[model samples]
Target: MSIVVIGSLNMDMVVRTKRAPEAGETLFGQEFALSPGGKGANQAVAAARLGAEVTMIGRVGKDSFGSGLLEVMKQEQVHTGYISQSESQSTGVASIVLDEEGENRIIVVPGANVEMKPADIEALESVIRQAGIVVMQLETDLNMVEAAAAIASRHGIPVILNPAPAQPLGDELLHQVTYLTPNETEAGILAGIPVESVDDAERAARILLQKGVQHIIVTLGSKGALIVNASGSLHVPGFPVQAVDTVAAGDSFNGALAWQLTRGKTLDEAVRFANAVGALAVGKAGAIPSLPRLQEVKQFLQEAAEAEPGAQ
Candidate 1:
């Protein structure tokens, strides 16, 4: 089955610092690195590396960064036939600062990503029609995201919306989403509740459900994730790992979850698998480079199981 990712494509510039800068103040960083990372591209690469057939639908500029982004997609085996290039705009970019503790702060410049319009999604109707699942994030224009969700809904294809960099959404968009995955902070913003614990996440998820989203998964960082639906709420624990950089952990989780769901795994199984993927990603340092391959994930899971008590 094919997965379509309709989102942004950006080059990430990361700075490793001892701590984030205060307002009106600056601090020297220890190191700097550049990598292919937009929420869309990162998720697409994560899924592709985990053996999913992924198609990326976004816009990039006709620049070196754009070229490098496309090259990364090709190397990851993600289909880039639907990706467009704009002559008027530069490629999108995210400037990120990571602290010694692995926490990060980011600022994104949409650039070419904002150039994606409903027309672009309409142009890829055939690709969306053939996809088993369509994954999206907030890096692109919200109008385009809504249009894509509507189109996928009309075609009866499942849509997984990860509300990253969370913003207010309308009922029309919420009604079209089959699954809504939001991290704690995002869920808190969308639901207008404090998502500090599993109970809080459940409450936030319930608010989303009332807004017409069918299923909700609120990721709780190291604590795990909360799964909520009409049936009830369930908490899936996260895998413990030493985090080096948390740049793409959430993206990896979303991608792996989508891939597992497409493979007919239950929500519990998918979340568990996604947790492993996220754990692996945070243990590394880059965005796309941190995503684990299918074999690596399987081996990691096997090792974790063996390390558990009372294993034969």
Candidate 2:
């Protein structure tokens, strides 16, 4: 299925350390490197690698980081025609700190990402109207996100909203989305409750359901994902893998889910495939570098099946 991602593009500067420092203390030990990231670009490249036709619609600065990000997306087979360059703004950046256990903390500077306005979404109306599914996130301006969602809604396109960075959302936006994917922290914020277990996630989803979101998916790191909709709720188990860095795991899941849904997979089937993609992502290090290709995911699942019959 053809997918369109409307979100942010960032240059990720990653630092690996033993563990996160305290309020005033500082400690560093491992390595530092630059990577291509931003939820939008990560998801786009992910679905593209999985054989979906994806177009990225976002703004980037006319800087080295922006240039590299565009180059990487093209290399991954994601269409870059819709991405625009902002001469006045510098490229967005994400400062990430990673611990030995693959856990991470991130601080983002929206930069050019936030420069995108509703006009930008209107300018690309035709492109968005043609998509099988339109994927979005909170890295960009809320108005722009709402604009794209409105366009997708007018055309009856499926809209997937990955509300990250844990912010409160309005009912208008929630009603416009077909799917709302939020991690434990994000779900907790949206539902006004603490979320740490499957039960907590389910309760939070129920609260969100009252707010008019069509479907709610709460991603629970190693515990897997819980899906809640008007009809009912279901939990899909995650695969066990040695995680190196879990930077883009959720992005991989969203990408894989969108790709599968576009290809006519049932919601359950898509979630299972996404779980595999996310597992593979956590096994690797960076954002874009961690996303698995179609064959890799197939093989991963195949091996899992062979190792433990019916495990996958």
Candidate 3:
């Protein structure tokens, strides 16, 4: 089964600061790094590295950053047939400040991402309809994401919604989602309930399910992820590692979860697999470059299982 990611592509410019800047204050950073990012691109890379036949749908600008981002996608074996170039706007960019605790604050300039229109979705509807899973993020226009979800629903193809950079979502969009995975903050924003802990996550998940979401997965940073469905909820503990960067951990989780679900794994099984993949992702440093290969995931899972017979 193939996976299609419909979203944005961006070049991330990051700085390592002691902490997030306060209002009216300027902080000096120790270093700077440029990386390949964008919720859509990161998820595509995560899925591709996990052995999925993946295709990306997004827009970039006629600039070096856009060119380099496409090249990175190609290197990850992600099909770029749906990618387009924008002459008027520059490619999307994210300016991020990462602290010593591996936490980050970001500012995004939508750029070409703001130009993604319904026509673009219609143009790629055929490829999207043939997919086993269609993953989307809020980095692009909300109407575009809604349009894609509508089409995916019509085809009976599952749509995985990762509401990153979370914003207000309409009931119609939530109802169309087969699976909704949001981090604690995003879940809090959507559910209108606190999701600061595992128990809080479970509460928020129930609220989302009541809102017509079929399934819910809340990423809890180092505490791992909470998986909730009609059956019940499960907390998947994260692996302990010294994280150099946590930028793409959530994207990796969403991608791996899609991969497992497409392979017919149950939600519980899929989340367990995804948790391992996400943990491994954070132990490394960039976004796309940090995604783990299929063999590596296998090795990590095997070793973990050997250590504990009853492990997930």
Candidate 4:
């Protein structure tokens, strides 16, 4: 089985500082680093590392960043045949500021990412049709996302939509998504309810169910995720870990969830696996660099299980 990711690719420029800059105040940072990241690319890398055959469909510039991004994908064994180069734009870039606590504030320049259009999805119809699951995010054009979802819907392929960056989507898009994964903030935006607690998350998820989304997974950071469907709801507690950077935690969860589901795991099982992935990701730093491989995640899960009482 294969997973197709249709979204953005960016070179992330990260700076470590004591805290975010004030409105007009500028402070010097402690460290600077560049890494391959973007919602789409990070998720693809996360899935690929977990043994998923992932094909990336997106656009990048003809610049060095684009070249490096493609090379990173290739090195990770993610298929990049569908990734194109934009002639008139630079590769997308994310300016990330990380505070002492590993919290981040990011500003993105869409650049070539904005060039990905609905036509791009049409041109790759065959690729999408051949995938076991199609994954997408809000980092790209909404129309393109909807187009991809529509294609997957017509072919009866399951579509996983990660509603990141918290944008308001229409019912047309929601109806096509087989699974919708959103953090608490995003769930609040989409469901029109404040997601402050587990009950709040469930209420918000119920609202999304009313909007036609088949399944809703509300990621609650340290609280783990709330999985809701017509059957009922399950709260998968998070794996406790000392987090260093949370940049790729959500992406790791999404990728692992898709991989586990494609392997025929139940929603509850998949979310539990995803929670382990997320915990491992936050223990490290950077985006793609932080995503744990299959062995690491498995070991972490095994250790956690054995650490419990009454083990064999």
Candidate 5:
């Protein structure tokens, strides 16, 4: 089975500090680094590292960042044939700040990500058609997301829409999504409720379900996830890990979820695997650099199961 990711490519500029600075206040930072990251690219790399045949469909600027982004994708074995170059826009970038606790604050500059036109989506029709699953994020143009989802829905492919950078979505897109993966904050905005706990997350998921989403998964960092569908809801518990950086934790979960589904795992099973992937991702620093390989996840799960004696 194969997965197609319709999203963005970016070079992340990251800074580390003891604590996040208040607005307009400058603080001394512990470190600074550059990483290839974008919600779409992160998901693609996460899936590829976990042994999935993944293809990325997006655009990048004609610059060094774009070149580096493509090279990293290739190194991760994510197919880059569908990635395009933007003549008018620079590659997208994200400014990220990580604190001592590994929490992050991000500001995104969409750049070439939003510059991708409808024609780009149209050009990838055939590629999307053959995919077992189609994954998308909100970093790219809204039209691109809808266009890809429409095609995937038409082909009977399951679509996993990770609604990051939370925004309201119409029913047409919601109805086409097989699974809507949103973190607590994103879910709250879509559902018009403040999500403060697992129970609150479920309430938000239920509200979104009425908006025509087939199933909704509300991701709770370190607390696991809440899945609500027409029939019922379930909570997939998270694994314990000392978080080094929470960046890409949600992206890793989405990627692992898609890969496990391709292998015929049940949604419940898939979410469990996804949780493990997310745990591992937060244990390391950086975005793409932190995603674990397939074997690592399996071993992590095995050890988890041994410790919990089937509770895993």
Candidate 6:
């Protein structure tokens, strides 16, 4: 029951400023930090920390960032067999700015992430086939995402798509997806509806399901996530936590959901765990450094349980 993530791996430069900059404006930053991040890497780390056998498939440049990024994956116990280094392109990068309110504005340079070709997926066919869940984001080449989905479909592996930085994809692509998890903005774009509330989320999710996605999970940040299926919908509200940075909160949710599914938990149960994990993530700073381990999650659940009024 391994989880495979096929997406981008990037070096992130995060800055904290008074507020997010406008289209052509610059502001003085209070602090700056370099971190290992990328939608792919963040999800992989999130899953690995939650006790899943995780494998990461992506590319990095043949530079220092590449070396360090590989080490980071190893440290997290994520299988790096499918990660490669390319000298032709530098590592992908994300320039992120967090305002005083913890809102972020980001710009991504695809770099080596864009260089990942379908052939890369083709070469990892064996690994892809062994996955119980294949998770993906839109940071890498969409062709590669499609190739992985195609292979996963052949093996009966469930494919989970998190269409972040939302882009247009096909019903063909949607048909191959076993689970489609998107934030409100992404759901709005994919379902062509104004997704401003839970009612809108249900409407949007139903539209995607009609397009052939087996399940739809629309993440609503502080509002938690809405899970929709043929049976109906359920809303799992977020845990109360003081948010310091919200960079990888969605990735953490996706990763935790995949881990729970691989462990044979129902989608409803998975969303509960994912909600807790995501709430914990935003309570800290930096993507990699903020991920909670399995033990930490266990402890959190225990504490929450003890705090409940209905006791022995």
Measured with C-alpha atoms, the lDDT of residue 146 in candidate 4 is 93
lDDT tens readout by residue for model 4, 1-312 = 999989889999999999999999999999999989999999999999999999999999999999999999999999999999999999999999988887899999989998888988888889999999998998898999999999999999999999988899999999999999999999999998788889999999999999999999999888899999999999999988887888888999999998998999999999999999999999998999999999999999999999888988
lDDT string for model 6 (1-312, tens) is 899999889899999998887789977899999999999999999999988999999999999988999999999999998898897999999999988777788899989998988887898999989888999999999998988899999999999999987998989889999999999999999999898889999999999999999999999888888999898999987777778999999999999999999999999889989988998899888988889988888888778778778954
Candidates in order: C-alpha RMSD to true structure: 0.8, 1.3, 1.8, 0.9, 1.4, 1.2
Which whole-number lDDT from 0 to 100 does residue 214 have in model 5?
90
Model 5 per-residue lDDT tens digits across residues 25-107 = 98999999999999999999999998999999999999999999999999999999989899899999999999999999999
* Candidate 5 clash pair list: none
Estimate candidate 3's alpha-carbon lDDT, on a 0 to 1 scale: 0.90
- Per-residue C-alpha lDDT of model 1 across residues 145-239, encoded as one tens digit per residue: 99899899999999999998899899889999889999988999999888787888899999999999999998888777889999999999888
Residue 274, model 5: Cα distance from true site in angstroms: 0.3
Per-residue alpha-carbon lDDT of candidate 3 for residues 1-312, written as tens digits (9 for 90 to 100)? 999999989899989988888899998899999999999999999999988999999999999999999999999899998899998999999998999888777889989997988877977789988999999999998999999999999899999999988898998989999999999989999999876678888898899988888889998877778888888888888766678789899999999999999999988789889989988988887788889999999999898778886776
For model 5, what is the error of residue 226's alpha carbon versus the real structure, in angstroms, after optimal superposition?
0.9
- TM-score preference between candidates 1 and 6, better one: 1
Indicate the residue-level lDDT of 155 in model 4. Answer: 96
- Supply candidate 4's per-residue lDDT for 191: 91
**lDDT value, residue 215 of candidate 5:** 85
In terms of lDDT, which candidate is stronger, 3 or 5?
A: 5
TM-score of 3: 0.96
Instruction: Show model 6 residue runs off by greater than 4 Å.
Output: 309-312
Question: By summed lDDT, which 10 consecutive residues of candidate 3 come out lowest?
Answer: 236-245
Q: Could you tell me the lDDT of residue 58 within candidate 5?
A: 90
Q: How many residue pairs clash in each candidate?
A: 0, 0, 0, 0, 0, 0
